[model samples]
Target: MSTAETLDDVAAAARACRACTDLPLGPRPVLRVSATARLLIASQAPSTRVHVSGTPWTDASGVRLRTWLGMDEAAFYDGRRVAILPMGLCYPGRLPAGGDAPPRPGCAARWQPRLLPLMPAIRLTLLVGTYAQTHYLGRGAMTERVRDWRRHLPRFFPLPHPSWRTTGWEARNPWFGAEVLPALRAAVAAALAD
Candidate 1:
């Protein structure tokens, strides 16, 4: 795809991207973004359900993420208010042992530089998984990054992936609920405030 000057052009180019031919579900490039968006959900990748639905965060993970952000589906999905951009736009397929595979190595490198510049309104980016946290904030334990969320303030907020697997982690880290979530919701609300 050629250089796209506008968000619509970038999004169109992204939707038509076929760079990663090895993707198990093919290159669906699922994402939701707009130039006016202020809150960015920087996640790992689309799940099988999101790939099939062609909508970012359309599964159980999304439910929990929205809950964490104190956002309803309407607000969460509004491209003008929020953007969902993952490390990999397409579903990378499942791991042999159990869970989904990590995102393709080249996807973010190819797209983020192009897409993010178009979103000048973005105030806070929520790094929603290990992939995202590592990509944006550099290598670190997700628990430590999330626990020290206040440090990355006014720009990025690190959080564990909101998958079913995270339930155990959340249970173990009671501070996530008792502390991080309230701050997260407030920051999100402040970012989205008109």
Candidate 2:
């Protein structure tokens, strides 16, 4: 089968996944991929807005991420260039304290290995936020991991979550803006280049 057709089959299976049948808001897998995609946006999980919209990164955080990559929405969302996949396919629901809960317990370990390899063209993976970084790069502080972006190289670029919570973090770490972002954007451009 063509990669697109194979991915379509995989997506269909993911959409019908009942692994988290007891999820608070139920399961609504939110991911996008294509065989031609060279960039992989590996994030934590879907927020309520993304779940409702059936689109990835449609909120303010998305704006920040797009800005960080110096990409317009069209390019970022283009399936042929980018694949948006999260640690959790569904919105794990809200926490009693406030923010959303962590992505359903073992979702990534269960699904990612099965899904990721299908995209053979992926050359640059933006490991956004703690969950994704922790999963792929192993347990580590977001600051340290993000600071050492060069270590991850052309394959993985670690980044803090682009949520409002990161405003203070970003302010405290000027180097991220002065250093990492430029390299990140350049790598993104290279990966998505025709």
Candidate 3:
């Protein structure tokens, strides 16, 4: 597709993207964005389920994510209020040992610049997981970045990916629930406030 000048145009182009032919499930880009979006969910690549479903955040991880943000499924899925854009639009396949592979190197670089400028209303971006945190905030340990989330300020909130694996991490760091969550919810409320 040609250069996209509007949000709709960009979305269309992203959906049609076939740049990554090596993707295991082929290219089924899953994302949600709108010009009015105030909060951005900057996540890792979609899981196989999400690629098949053609919707962003449709798995267990999504459930926990919505809980973290104190939003219902309806509110979370409302593109006008929240934009869900991952580092990789398509599923990059699984690692031999386990877990999903890292996002394709070029996907975000190819699309973020085009999409972000059009989303002038985005007040805060949630970097959900190592990929997003690294890409946006530079190299750092996930725990450190999340622990020091306040330094990123009203513009960004660093978070661990809400996969089942986090259950253990949450237990280890009780402060995440007691401190970071409340602050995160407040930040989200402020960002989404009318």
Best by lDDT: 3
Candidate 1 Cα deviation (angstroms), residue 19: 0.8
Stretches of candidate 3 exceeding 4 Å from the true structure: 1-4
Candidates in order, TM-scores: namely 0.97, 0.95, 0.97
User: How do the residues 31-76 of candidate 3 rate in per-residue lDDT, one tens digit apiece?
Assistant: 8989999999999999988988999889999999989989998989
User: TM-score of model 2 relative to the true fold?
Assistant: 0.95
lDDT of each: 0.93, 0.90, 0.94
For candidate 1, the 10 contiguous residues with the lowest summed lDDT are 2-11
Q: Rank the candidates by lDDT, best first.
A: 3, 1, 2
- 2 against 3, candidate with superior lDDT: 3
User: What is the lDDT, from 0 to 100, of the residue 53 in candidate 3?
Assistant: 90
lDDT of 2 by residue, 19-53 (tens): 98788878899999888899999999998889889
